[model samples]
Each structure stands twice: as structure tokens, then as C-alpha cells.
Target: MTESSLSISVLLVCRDSAETSLITEVMRKFGISVRHSVETEALELVKYQKFEAAVVDFNVPLASMILDQLHGSASNKTAVTFAILNGKSGRASSLKVRASFVLHRPLSPSLMYRTLQAAYGMILHERRRYFRCPIVVPVTLQKGAESEKTSAHSVNISQNGLAVSTPVPLGPGTSVAAQFKLPQLPPTIAAEAAVRWYRDGKAGLLFLSLDPSLRSELSEWLSRRMEAFLRPVQ
Candidate 1:
């Protein structure tokens, strides 16, 4: 995405009424957008939606529920979460659960800013590696080490990769050759791509090598998509 379009939006799940507003203000002061609500509403949001990153007060009543629902077991994980460690019962045990980062009480502005900065950095890095924009295209996928071909549908295309839902998932880091046609283009786009990630039947493919001509075509396609993204909607 373009610099103007890129933003860091985090889910805030703190219960301290004063600190909740204060935290939101702090995020805005750092130029990071924050989405927050009452503890009840926030819990509901985390249950069904994923955020770029989530900052949560692990001391709240619904904290564990949020974690279990959003960052659960391996097959159910969604978003990276940062929890504030409050010294309460079961706090130490909760440490066993997965969290991007955890901090103790008595927060400072600089510390908070830096923490979120880290979270944003992590999010951006993940995006660069596997982030995708919406697109639909048919792809003929062939594993680099295998001769079998699999039919797949590209759901979103990104700078480094594309997300595809196929009948079978290509193992992560497996090199592959792909042939596909993007919308609004004249020629077929083909590249040596590597499977960067996979879950269920969907996988992310990172283009490892793009010849000059194909690179030029892909760049043009990306530029067009970015322009459309920047265009104001009616």
C-alpha cells in the first residue's frame, strides 16, 4: 500500500475507565489509530473480527476469553496480542498462553509508545511478507520439486505474494512455478513463487523470481490497483 494509505489500527481492551481514554489519547498522540470500546463491546469485537494488533488489559474479566477466542490454539489463531500483566490470581498461569508481548503495571508513555511501535513494526513486517490485496485469478500451480499440477484461485495479490485457496495446500517454503492472468492485463503473468504460509486449504505464495518483462507487467498491475485504492469512493 502507498504511504498515505498505510495505517496501524489496533484493538484496545482496557477496563480502567480513565486509563482507557488515556490510552486511546496516547495512541492518537503517537499517530497510531486505536479502536476501543467498553470491555463488553471489545470482547464481542474480538470474538468475531481480527485486528492488525491488539493491546489488552489481561486483568479484566473477559481478558482470558478474548485471548482464547482471538489467539487460541494453533489452528485457531488470528491476531497478535499484547497484554498488560496485572498481578492477579492465575496471572502467572495465563503466561502460558501466547501473546506477542506482555508488560507489568505502572505504564509510562514512552514505554507504551514503544510497545505499540514494536507491535506496528511486527504487523508491517508480516504484511510485507504475506500481506495481500483483493484480486481473483485462476492459477496453475506446479511444485518445484514435484511434477503434479494443482488448480487454485488467487484471492488476493500483494507485492511479494498472493493468497490462494486450493484443494491442497502447498507446504511452506516449497518453491513453485505459477501461471496466471491478472485482470486488466493483456499477457499471462508467470513467476517462480514459494509457499510462504499455509492454513487449511489456503496458502500464501511469495514470488521469488520475476523476469524483467513479467516484473514490469506485475508492477503495472500493482500500480493500477494502488491508484484504484487511492481513488475516492462515491
Candidate 2:
């Protein structure tokens, strides 16, 4: 549960055996393992087990039922679910298929790969945000035409960014030098960051130019946080 990977269990739902078989095999080639389950029982599986994604045929009547069952359920809440619809039917059901991405049938392999990649990232990003740690750390932000520097405290930290509590919040697009150190990391990490959004005294900074070394360090730190976050509370 702590370590993450591109590898994820997928729920494959479709009426046609050939389409499901082709898609499942293609997913395996991309290093994504999947489990094809009947729609009748898949909802219960989705509710009780962890599935990172689901590929469904939008044309099937059961597809909507699967979506309805898993939409807010814990197992599928953050799972990346996408549908395959006929090109002509894409528009009609665009509003109906509750998927993270919708690809037309007669699917392009390249496009599907890229779509799944994006969906995987989105799923992981949401998971991190949900498990963000509430740890305050020293933060120094430098910004503006005057190169003004300010002291702040990180309110919460995730792999992507940290929300900062500063005396003065900068504009949304202001670029800055962000410096901080987490307990899991040794040296102070500095990165070129930008204010993503600001409200009142808090601003969220997205690290922009993190070097590979620093990114590796940060990734390790985040992995540790993930482990701690997923530990069952006794």
C-alpha cells in the first residue's frame, strides 16, 4: 500500500469478448495488469478491493450501472475509469459516461496509451493529495520585481507542492525561490517555484525547476510520508 507503481489492477467491462480480450492484452503489454470481471459481480469487487482503473465500453447498458455503483465508492472513488464509445456516439454519451477519459471505439493504440498514462498520473496525484501530511516546516519565499523575501510556514506538504502560510500572499503567477527541509531529507531543498493560487495569508507553491537529485530526495521523502499516511490507526 505504501510503494506505488505504474502497475495497477484494472476492471475490464464490455459486452464483446473480443474487444475485452484485445484491450486486456494491450494493457498487459503496457505493464498494466488487469482483471476482467462480469458487470454483475464487478461492483462488489470494486467496493471491497482496490482497483486503480477501469476500462468500460460505453455502449453497454451495464456500463452505466458499473459507474453508478463505483462512482463514490471507496475502491473506485479515486480510480481512473474511462470508456470506449463509438466515434459517432461519443457526443451523445459524452455527458453520460462517467470516466476519467473517453476514447472512441476502433481505438488508436497510441492515443489510448497516452490517455492511460495521463489517467494514471491523475489517479496518483489525487491519492497523494488525499493523504497529504499536516506538518509545518520552515519556508522561505523570494519573489517580485524587488526580489522581496518572506518567511513562511508550510501548512501541508504533498509530492506536488506545499501550501504556505505567509505574512503576505503573493499574486497567483509570481515566481519564487522556495527553500525548505523535511525531516526525512537531510540538506535544505531549494527549487524554483511559482505561486499557483493565493487566498488571504496562504499560498500554494508549485515547484518548477527541481533538479533530478532534489526530485529523487523529495520522492524518497514523499514515499516515507506515504507509508506513514497509510498505516492503520489502531
Candidate 3:
């Protein structure tokens, strides 16, 4: 993979200045942007921002708690996580924390680069799911056989759900059948979705029953869109 051509955002939680500098430098080389945070503030940041990956230092007092928060967060649960261990002794504990990768202490640039390369694919896959593409498309929503169909326009779309603006917003917990077409996807994507939230004439629909093939198509479409924006015109 051409690591430098990809765009990835990571949450770096390490209080050690020396280690932080080394990690930051290595990540930059791979075209990944790091948002540095201490263990205390990292928990809150994970709740709000969407990151493809996170690197936490196990030596931090609240490191485990921060990892818990990251995995528990709805927005960040799937984020690829890396645990920085001071020595081999922390390996077993790091496994329990479920970090996607582990970096041992006395981290060298070569070691960091290798680990990042190993996790790069997973990071991109997670990043693709978090990416929201803005496109207005006509969408038909039907709650049930007896209910009237609602016509709405999509505000934005992600791998798991869609945000749509409607004349009347559907209430949360409402189940609906959605049918819409993406730019290059030949067939109309139809899936059963649940209304996750509603506000100000808009509702968020979580796709609960999308077919695997359709999901693959949607993922590919979104990846293309992301690459288009990130890559310069040729």
C-alpha cells in the first residue's frame, strides 16, 4: 500500500513527552494525523470525535479506563487500538484490554513503522465506515404495510446509517424500510432501518438489515468518494 497517499486520524494518549514525539513522527510519515491527549482528557475526546485508531500508554494511571471508554463509546468502539507497554511484562494485560496492536518500550522508528504498516488496512476499513458522504438523493421510507410511505432526501450517508431530512421527522424506535440509489451503484439499496434519533425535521436511520453484497458495494462507493477528495486531481 502507498501509505503516504492515505489519510488517517488517530488519537494518541501518552503522557511521556519522549515517546509521544517518537510516535507522532512515525505516524506522520505514514500520512496519519495524531491528536495527542492525556488519559484523563482522552476518554472525553473518544466520546465526541471519530478516530480510525488510538494509541494508549499502559503506564498511564487511567489507561485501562480510557481503553474501556473507547471501546464502550458508540462512535469509537470499532477504532483500531494500540497499547504501548513499558516491557514484555505488560503483554498479557494488554491482551485483556483488547488492543489491536502492541508496541514495546524503547520504541524505535523502524518498529513503529512496521506496526503501523501492519494495522494500516484495518485502520482504513474502520475509517471508511466512519466517513460520511454528503449527497442529496430521493429516499422512500415505509414503516409498515399499513403505514403511509414517507419521501425524504438524504443529508448524508455512512456505512451503518443515513441522515435524512423529511417534512415530518420520524420518532426514535420507528422501524422503516428504506430504498435509495447511490451515484454509481446500479441497483437500489434497500434495507430495514431503525430511526435512531429525530430532530428539527431530520431523522437518523440505522441500517439494521442490509445485505452483505449491498454493504460491500456501499463500502466501496464510500471509499472511492473519500479517495477522490483526499487525492489531487490528475
The top-ranked prediction according to TM-score is 3
Q: Which pairs clash in the backbone of model 2? A: none
In the range 1-234, model 1's lDDT, one tens digit per residue, is 443234445688887877677677766654445777657887677665545667778777777777776665332264667787754654676667567887666777777777766675565443333334577789999885458888999978877778888897678888989888887788887889999899999998888987788777776677566445433223
How many Å off is the CA of 34 in candidate 2? 0.5
Ranking by lDDT: 3, 2, 1
lDDT of 2 by residue, 161-183 (tens): 78989998589988989898889
Which stretch of 10 consecutive residues in model 3 shows the poorest summed lDDT? 1-10
Summed backbone clashes in each candidate are 0, 0, 0
lDDT of each: 0.70, 0.74, 0.85
Ranking by TM-score: 3, 2, 1
Tens-digit lDDT track of model 3 for 1-234: 244324578999888898899999988766677899877788789888788899999888888898889999998999999989977787667667778898888788899989988998898778776677778999999999798988999998989999999887688999999999988889899999999999999999999999999999998898898766444222
Q: List candidate 3 segments past 4 Å from native.
A: 1-8, 47-50, 71-78, 87-98, 142-151, 208-213, 226-234
Off by over 4 Å in 1: 1-6, 29-31, 73-78, 87-94, 128-234
Predict model 1's lDDT versus the native: 0.70
TM-score of each: 0.51, 0.52, 0.73
Q: For model 2, what is the error of residue 80's alpha carbon versus the real structure, in angstroms, after optimal superposition?
A: 1.2
